[model samples]
Target chain A: MRKKGLSLVTALSILSALVWLAGLAWVLQDQFFADNINRQAETLKPDTAQQQKEDSSGKTLQIAAIGDSLTRGTGDPDGKGYIGYLKEDLAKKTKKRIELTNSAIKGQTSVQLLKQIQQPQIKRQIKNADVILLTIGGNDLFRGGQALEELESKTINKTEDVYLSNLKAIYKKIRMLNKNGIIYHVGLYNPFSDMQDSKTTSSIVRKWNYDSANAAAAQPNIIYVPTFDLFELNVNDYLYSDHFHPNKQGYQLIGERTASLIHFREEDQK
Target chain B: MNKLVHNELLKLFRKKRLFVIILIIAALVPLFTYAQYQEVKTTREKLGNVDWRTQLQQEIVDTQNRLSSSRMQDDWRKYLKIRLAQQQYYLDHNINPQAPGAPTFMRVFVENSIDLLLPLLVMVVAADLVSSEASGGTIKLLLTRPVKRWRILLSKYLALILSVSFIVTASAVLSYAISGVVFGYGGWGMPLLTGFSTSGEELVTNTVHLIPQWQYILMEFGLVWFVCLVVGTLTFMLSVLLRSTAAVMGIMLAALIAGAILSNMVSSWESAKYLFMVNLSLTDYISGMATPIEGMSLGFSLIVLLVWAIGGLVVSFAVFTKKDVY
Candidate 1:
């Protein structure tokens, strides 16, 4: 009986070890044999027939917005950032049903956003968009207002160069994925216009916007929408309590300008 | 050899401490399940009338807000980024961010079980495995049996390994059974996605694996079992070196706790990654939780743990075979 028990114990130990080993192997297999779906260089062309039909029938106009906190609806008490208000504005202007898939995450910089756009879900959203809205470079430029306060022109210039290249890469990648969608790259506004170093901060923001707008102009079908003028006169009225993000009124002003731009081509078609 | 292992197993089971360990595990599961239930209640209340996508967006904003604060650490910021990416993934896919259920509770339990408490319990058994015999004068009787000292020590070590395996499995099983009663025995077939992020880098959201809940649990158990084996082996070595069970247990407990504390405190210190204590959390890497140190990969941690386990085994075997019994 004792001999039988000893063998039973040994067999059980071996069995348990084998089971655990098998589990470890199975889980590790995914890491070792990962699929190359993300790396595949295939571009998904937007279906023209569907677009033409939607254009004719005034069907749902799919809009995908990808970027940082400004695109994520932060600081607005209603939590509907510019994208939410943009959807409402677009819905009011056109008979087409507006379907907006906002894939913007808060605190994301240009490099992070570039990586986010590569995700399969975001790719799918981008593939189906009639218009792709973006709001980046805020985190890249502002860096939580620390850079604005310090006022290092050389450091700001260096950071802007890296951001512009990242922006260029982002625009290229987006166009590669969806060749026909109109890409509206939203320009930055001066959140520190009310601050002590408002003049220097404004100039730096203006230069960054100018370079970014020029980058947008270089790409076909990518339009750069300026917002510096919107907050130039009433920065406090538009900014939230946090002073970083826009309040509801601020997002409304942005939404109105974006809506007018979006409506321009459709009104031309009409 | 088998009889020696059998006898060691019998002696281990005869200890009341083993039963107390089971009792403690049994009691903790309900408390954790209740806490999970409370969390779900509060989340549901907080998210009332709001869609999951909107909720996820708000959660991302909250995380970002916390991250912007100067008090937050770099490790926490990295972890929040991964969490934000995960919530974004779920939002994009329209999957509800984890509602409290048996599977969710079990997943949390498994993730948290590998911490100091579980290792401490495993060490309790290991710290006494060899030392208890020496303290009780049973080593002389065992030596009189004609079996080689190496064989005798090997049997005790095997018994400790077996006990560690049982303890880990038992914890998993008990957590599931108890949580199943409260939340229902469902979600075994639900999909669980894990995303691994490189140290200090943005979360690689695209590299997610959608394994079933059962497979995730199995893999978690496997990872925890390896950690337990390392803890048990190291404690067994300490048991052999120190004749007093209390001394072995105290030292092992202190080391395990210190490892957990150090992993949290000195996560930025690159050399902390090489410490065996810091590498005990293999589940974090596999579950796609942010690693303590930047750049510490699953493979790197496994190597670190393997080196420690082997070194401990070699030291234990060498000392046991050569040391005088008297």
Candidate 2:
């Protein structure tokens, strides 16, 4: 038995050594002298058929949330943001499973968002979403308090013009991606409602929301959900420690509001 | 030389060291398979059986959210950024990088073990190759043979190489046979992407190409075999220099564990890249992970390990031939 085992092991080891040596040679040849022409010719065409197969048998509701930090749940200790709260509320109301793909980046402006939604995976998410949630224009407007420092209507107007066009383009892209999905563009609330320059900031945010709502209105099945009133009265109580992002209670309020809108749509469909 | 190597192999087989290594691998593979099975189960449950694309999309979003935070360490942030780009590349190419299969498990297992677990096993077989003979007073009798001292050492080295190859092969076979029970054995033909390289924080996919999972595993095992051979050679050198097997193991264990720890924080050390332990993660280059140091590539690591192995061989032969046997 010992002699037989010794020979068998030696033979096996020698064979393995040779095979691995071949693999090593292949690695050098493949990595260093890769045929660039073959690689370039192997352009990856996104498999749309498999994606449709995933969509057609979907019993669950695919909710795709894309945009800025609010959609990303920044400042919330739980990191649920408004989307998390909204998901909880929807779960309570609906029997179907809620699968959320939140592709929001914190501090993302409208321009960045336009670029983000253009990514192949993000576009696939949008295409598969039964309902789309959008919360942009915060970073474009707040600029992380830089706008508060530069409270010039001239600069604000210039920013809004660029933002409005981006918003239009984003809406066109979403609509083009999924014709049936309802878009709920969550309007921004003024975190500085109780501050000294509340009037100017509030007006600026309202006008920005108004233009975005108008852009949403132009697209079919797009509903601009109002969140301005939720924080208008107790803005300080709802604001987080940063005095910028919404606290847990504020996210819950936004979540409850969006959940109500989605409920109404479910009822309409029924 | 053939008879000498055969004699060495006989001694090695009589020790049943290879059997123990195989046993160790078999015992550990199931534990990892269970852990991996639990992870996939939980992810599927959390995502409500959504397609992999959505799951990957969610992960990308989560990484983006983490990247947006201010408190993350710079190195960690860079690693995450590179990983995010690689994951995106996988998604864009419509390839499921983590598709569950026995082959996938083997690839992941070998990639993880190449640095530490595997080298330790190789050490077990190699650390006592010469030291035990010396410490047992068998060296005196062996040296009296008409065979040249260098040939004896060369036979020992060849035997070590064969056994190192055997250990790596055992791991690959055992991991696949065991993990296949749970993950199924179908992903051998599954398409995978490789040749992803990183520059700073950017994942350079200009050279990215598709290869089947079997080829990927073969290539990774090749890298694993090379890493183990270097580690085994170093241990063999120590075995020759020391009369105590325990001392050989202690030194190697310290160096390997230190290398594992240093690879985490040595991003700033800049010069630790020359150590063979840090360079043991040669598989990472193939999978396109962020290197421990800024400039360590597969080619760079391969060359570093080769130099060290050559140095170890030279020192082993020099000391073994010249040392006075009591």
Candidate 3:
């Protein structure tokens, strides 16, 4: 009886071991096969060796603009957003051509943009750029707009001064990194221009533009373009039916005005 | 009592039962590790030239498209939730879930649970644990000793419990040791995605917070032993319940196989939750990969399994302690 029991154990033990081995084999599929995607994002910082490929003069001008929903094709029917209009306008006016890279993620702030710009892939492009057009610090201002039911007409201003300082710091840092670059600090557009508190928020918005212009003025090759006039008090002419982003006409007008502004700058530089 | 427990242990090791457990560990450990190693190697080779974030974003978009294209309306939302979460997580953290996360030891220890093996190992030696002695008429000689019948049974039970615990610990430790050989020993500090959810709210799926993978293994083994203990106890019960050892083994085996099959097939029937076998593979349901019979939560499944186990123990003790040892 003992020998028979022992024999049964031996045979069963072998079978059990085989099955257990199979189960273990099934579970460890990831370690041997799965890709290390995380390391890929971090390993490649801006390759400094690629820094020698500079054009020295005006090659094809590469422009990068970033911002919130307006820049993210949020309110655009065709989904090209402002970058497309800006590109068409610039191409039509300059007729020389430009490379536009729109890296604008929806609902991003300046702090986020700064971090994004520091990424190796983006930093490489920014280094070779002739112009950097950016629309930012809007989401930071009107973040409470999402809670529109609870807080409307009430401006979030006190902490905004710090926001502006952060914005200044980002611009200053970018200027230091990329010398001889023209900075187009695209000012805010009043989507809520019809509101009674629109004028007060407009100054708050203008102060950012004014502060940005001053900050840009203090740094060489930085220019602030005031776009508030194109949208404020004439809400109907520019804004979409949603009263958030601008319509095609509104975008075209802004594009045309921006193209004109760049033309004047080119003439001034020449 | 201690001598008997030790005697039981010695007797256990003297046979193939202990060797089977060791064999399982030896075979499974390296296999699990190598599988993990292969995964990393394949990943390394595929990502040999590709950019990580773009690849990750593309994967997310691909998965999103796949989810959007197929799946019925009811299944669509769940698939979308998974896709949406991946996209949000990718945009926020720049990670691709379909890509590699951790080494083999951590993956095996945490994700794919070894719930089936323990009860199975128990079932191997368990059928003939006591009844085979009676069937071969060796009980007459064994009982001739000063050791009482209940004492003998108690010793066997204790011995069985000790062996079960040993098998559990061995399986888990071997999994870690073997996987470490292939994947490297980096799992100690690594974070794992232990994400589980009921409704829409995101649960912190970080595999680190709730418990270590080893503890999860231990808990799993504990539940396995408890379930197997019930199996062993019932087999031991049947050894007394019937005169034929073959009949006892066959009945228990059939019950287990039927339970496994019925758990899957006997769906929509709410009462199927009470079946002990339905909850045997408890980890799958606990991780929310599959649902327990209607209205069954992890806690609910645990209670059901425990009750069946304890109830089995009661029947085994009652029947075995009072059996005619003719």
The order of the candidates by DockQ, greatest first, is: 2, 1, 3
Global lDDT scores for all candidate models: 0.79, 0.90, 0.59
Please report the candidate that would top lDDT against the real structure: 2
- Candidate 3 lDDT tens digits, A1-270: 866755454344345444444433432332223244233334433345644435445546667665555665556677666677777767765644476655566667767777766654455456666777777877777663332322333444444666677777778777766887787777777676688666666666676677767777887877777778888657786777877777777777666666666652363232
- Angstrom error of the Cα, residue A195, model 1: value is 11
Q: Judged by DockQ relative to the true structure, which candidate is superior, 2 or 3?
A: 2
All candidates: interface RMSD:
6.8, 1.9, 11.5
**How well does each candidate superpose onto the true structure, as a TM-score?**
0.66, 0.96, 0.51
Q: List TM-score (chain A only) for every prediction.
A: 0.77, 0.92, 0.73
True contacts kept of 3: 0.00
TM-score of candidate 2 restricted to chain B?
0.99
For residue A139, model 1's alpha carbon misses the true position, in angstroms, by: 11
The better-scoring model by lDDT among 1 and 3 is 1
Off by over 4 Å in 3: A1-270, B43-63, B70-113, B146-148, B193-231, B242-249, B255-267, B285-288, B292-294
Which pairs clash in model 2? none
RMSD of each: 8.4, 1.9, 12.1
